[model samples]
Target: MKTPYRLILLCFVIFLTLEGSTPVPTEKTSFQWKWKENQVLELNEYHNVFFRVGAKTVEREDKNRVVMKPKKCTPDSCLVNSWFDTYIRYGKTSGPFWKDKEFTSDFTLFRNGRYEVPNEFTMPNLRSFPSFPETPVSVSDVWKLPAEESFDFNSERIRVKVIPEYTFQGIFPWSEGNYKGNCEKITYTYPIFYSKPDGEKMVPNVPYKIFGFASGTVFFNATRGVPEFKEVKLSYTFIYPNGTVQEANFHIKGIYFLRNQINTKDKESIREDILGDLIVGYTGDPNGSKLGDRIKDHNNDKEPNGKNLGRITDTGEIPRPEKDSSLEKLPVSVRTSEDGIVFSLDSILFDFNDSKLKPDAETAVAKIAEILKKYPDREIRVSGHTDNIGKKEYNRKLSEDRAKSVLHSLVDNHKMDEKHISFKGYADDLPIAPNDSEENRHKNRRVEITLVLD
Candidate 1:
């Protein structure tokens, strides 16, 4: 009696030791990003006007194309204004005014250059103008002012000023100093064309030559003056032909320049690192195959060498198959449902109302045993189930016993390793048929085998 009790206690101790020695798997980490408000730019109506010195007329022929000759002036001192209008015949369609409307002024002229008008200043009416080779006049002939005047034709000696107001909107109080403000100015030169009534054409010397001039720049300045939401106004002044001045105001509304805020709540990089480590440790693809391929492709294109090299793994080595289990040599199959091996046993394969594997189940169990022997390193899981015929608790125990019986054969009779085998017994918890029918209940009583890992 003492020996038996001692033996049981020793077994119990061994079970406890084995249970405690089991490794606890690490939990995976995920990532997300958070965004915050930065700054905004508000614009208004005060920034909407065009200034030039040209005649307005009703005669359609003379009002086709006009040019403004550049003039010399001191910085921030000159101001001029003029009205411009194009003919609009009844019952006609036309493109946008900005596409057809054009202005040419020579602030300075060292060498002659050609200017192409922008498409934004289109005529309001589709009424086509008579196409003439000499319609657009030259800048030299346009200015009627005397040569003695200071605004004479000298593009290099002229100065043009464009002042644009851009409002900044922000979440922080306007007076707060938490955020810094800055602005950038960019200038683009393009060709633009305009039409003026022939009689309204002011420059007396030139009547039908296209005047070439440089376009102005767009300015954004936070320190100079900020635009308001109501009516942000920007002024542009041009001095042309012997001290003559022209000015225009552009009225812009709802113009805001917002900057991206610094994010503090994001631990995405850390989380991604964690996930990447986990995936590499499990799936062995630290920089995922798809992502690594993309990076490699992009780098190859951008680099001068442009070599199509494969991705480098996290361990600073090219990803390759293990020597023992090369993926290239593995057999692959594509089957919709019944692709791999199948295990089937009759109803008499187990004891009545119990999960114990009977003598008759030997054939089926032998087949599975052979499979396990063939794939020694593979992990197998055996699950036992039963029909809804008895009490839930009783059925659960029976199924568990049946699973244990099957596992015992594999481990003991077939000499399979116990570490690679797992067993689970679920009574009627998961069913293959409805309990209302006898046929379905019978179908539910069975055992299943799965290949977990290789």
Candidate 2:
């Protein structure tokens, strides 16, 4: 008898130790962005322009002539145009002689007008040229093929050898100026020209238009027949195949000079308004119109607008669920002399006034399943309880219903053995809290699980 009692006590101690050693469930993982929050720009802001050199081919009429006839060749005979515009507005009273000045221009032609290889060729030094300015007024360029052919025509060759040449030029003009005031008005215009063959061979002439504002003070002076030169500053830029960019600035002094100056305290405001008007006029409202807004609507039937919504993982933060020890560890039990095994049913099991198990409780259920699978001789007791929420009879029925719900979920969803499961319900008599406040009331309603060891 003493040995049997000792053995039973040892088994109880081992069971308690194993139950306490079970680990608690851990939190779930989440995703987040790596960059700083303030560094990002507003959705409406503008980004820089990206340009690429397209196909290029060159044709020569004769190989060894001082003056060669230029002809169109494969992939090379292409033209690209880029443009910028600005505006200037004067008061309604100021409508008179405002001479527009044509400033310096620049151009760069590749040897055979070919695309520049990204990392292979070194950029040409802009300082090497005397005629090129440190800044440009208006610049344009074309990539041409290399003057020499260094690669074979074999179709099987994996790599080809190619060399490129570049021709750069800059133009600086006389002057520019503006005047306002007087009743009379006048307007003048100027044009700039560019050509190939060292200024000897001429491609078609391209024109740049400039306008001036002479009003208020200069308008009166213009009525008196005053002659003046208005000076304007211009800048041009060209990009080469070797990844080098060259810029030239020219000062056409007195090209549109004015004899009088306008009198006003709102110079800066006027300038900004003019600039805004020009940008909108040319770009068709940079902020986009109603049509653009409609197009951007995700649910619209039309195609999606060009917009980068960023990654889905970066949208918002996910909240973490509450932790509960009872939901993480399994309950300990021992075999009863009458029944197979018996355990207690406490009010610390399910959520307040609810039969559904919390997310954390799922882990506890999973662990119980694992144990039952290991010990096929075990049984489970699912019991429910309620505090003093209503009459004793109603409370008892509600508790019983809650207990049945938990058992059904375990047996149906978790595929547990139905024959090994039993349930019990306790009314308000089994209150775990004082039931004084809402918080305490929540603790009074719950369903507990007890494993019976065979």
Candidate 3:
């Protein structure tokens, strides 16, 4: 053990040189958003915002379906456009408030995740993790975000400067959407501090100051070159002049899923091919459908109720599909996904390898249409799928034909509006379970009609 100190020192030097020559996991490659033309990614976001104002906890759960596609690109950045279908559902709030909005917007995003969104959107949660570093970042590396920001104070508006920090938390196993590989994790946090403006004390404005913090974690899948998942929460504390305090919290979670694009298109395009167009399509909300129609004295919106309990029309009861005996007997699998309520009709709805609807399937679709009329304000999407039974190209066309058949029946026969409905075929790209067994494969070969909640 005491052979020679010089030899031991030489061995240590050799080990250090070997380690230095080998690049670290993060340093091996730079992280960038590699959005390709005709490639589409859907971000299904679920947000829960609750404010603990004194004793009451006002809560809300809203969903967003944002379909993003690369429009045009330069060497450094690209113009990304998205369709935003969002809806809000308030619980135990001041009034029964519901909103269904659909719009299209544009964004300019760089390779490092820096982006400029149009004034149409205010996505605080999406931007919780600031832009990525310009250079390669190794594990434990830290950076400071732009700290200057403005907000409304109790008495007046003010802009303050504060430091927000982001750190590289190294790589971990990431398996989401269609990609599976090592993923980089980034964590961010920022403190909230606002001293009260110079003013007199009052009951409504007694709170002189508020302070809190916001923190979250987001994952970046290097394989896909995109954000994989995100979870963020923000909290604030309001201090009253009497030394008492009130608190509020906001939480959000989002997941990104990439759609499978058609590989061959002898005639038709593989993707939507609508990326070059920028049409501001805003289907009006359900303004004509009064909330009071569904609830008795729910919002006290007497305008609709007029002389009767503030409702559009009072039947003294609530109408629900689950209560309809005839509709409840249908042989359909209804479930909820990131997209919303999905009514899945299995391959039995059609003959083997056929897109035409069976004779009995028509009756089932008609019944489903009747139920769909209840959600007139919601958007509907008809999607076709199949098992891995044949060539992908054939399956793709078959799925598309099946989806179109259902869509036409809903629109032409049932008199359903076509403006709020759309259809697509995914071949065998999406499967509820593994295609290892006949039962699972049968589940894969199904058509799903979803009510877009976003």
Candidate 4:
């Protein structure tokens, strides 16, 4: 869901190589994350947001963010299994001002800390992770990694690639609730400055001049290779050439827990109960094209459910279809994995090199829609994939089109719920087989409709 932006500012380009010019310690430790199957990680996060106008300033300092991640990692990324957080509040933490709003979503997280979610245009605050070096780090190590901060400008995508300089502060003894012992810390920060070109006039709701800085520190457990604590502070101001001037500041803090075992007391419901909130709705549209605008329109309002599509993760380990279950006898390759129940359909469902669904393919999808109705509580994702046979972007576009076709069939023709369904074009990202032979390549070209169980 990338909006084609014609403006390729200097913000979009940076050195792709790491700068390990400084060295102090010979021994090194890789900061890449390691996780076991079904491991659960929790983040009891809190946030503080501040805004300023000509003569007025409004700030909220006691906001809470609740996140849950179960280690369902593929080779490429990890499913932030289920993400739910409270709405941002502007005043006292109690009374009508208090909100229990929640949205469950599937946030794709990499081994390195980073969020793929889009940020608001006027005030850029996409919770992006400071990129980590692929190689290990030693004491006094300094490196550069681009933090891809995505935004929407005039209804199109404006991606900012800023280099966040990171320094490995080395490991030190640390202790926190449920986690204690040696932990490694990294300090990171990046600056932003933008001004309008000479000939262009300022656009409404967009800043012609921007200046900002982001600084943060992250600590990870050395033994477990996971972030145990993080604190980020961001301050920025957007000055419009024709309109009003605005300033914003945000502070984010997170307390992370790595749960190695899950017993009766470790269920999500229990965790939700601890928060004393029971509301849920739409989630962050990380790859959402217009998601930034939709959220900005709300100000402090919660995102409505079923209106815009978002990713959702299954609740617990869903059971595989039984021998006599309807799915076990379906025409597609139906299997249950750490993600969910995936329905894989081969590329033959479409015409050669075409994205439209063949008439018969529509029928097959209609059947899937009927079965999907049985699990009304579950969320759904329709992903299109292709083999390595053509231009990468072309293949991605084709996959996106094909996946949308299937999604439309389920929603329009079968009247399936669209609110809980999202589609993505993962061209050659998660391949089922290698492209070494024609047979394997054929297997790689397909569309998968997953019934993400709740």
Clashes of 1: 69
lDDT of 4 at 320: 42
Candidate 4 lDDT, tens digit per residue, 13-114?
A: 011123674543458866656655455555555556777878988776443334355445565466554544343345633211122333555555565555
TM-score of each: 0.26, 0.24, 0.46, 0.46
TM-score of 2: 0.24
Clash count in backbone of candidate 4:
1
After best superposition, candidate 2 residue 448: deviation in angstroms?
0.7
How far off is residue 296 in model 4, in Å?
51
TM-score of model 1 (CA atoms): 0.26
Q: Comparing candidate 2 with candidate 4, which one achieves the higher lDDT?
A: 4
Q: Which scores higher on lDDT, 1 or 4?
A: 4
Candidate 2 lDDT over 206-321, as tens digits, reads 11111121111001121122222222232333333244333333322211111122223233333223222212112332455443242244234332322221110111222222
> Model 3: per-residue lDDT, tens digit, 71-105?
67776677766677664557732221123455676
* Candidate 1 C-alpha lDDT tens digits along 366-425: 555765576553435566778888799888888767777777887777787654465667
Worst 10 residues of 3 by lDDT: 5-14
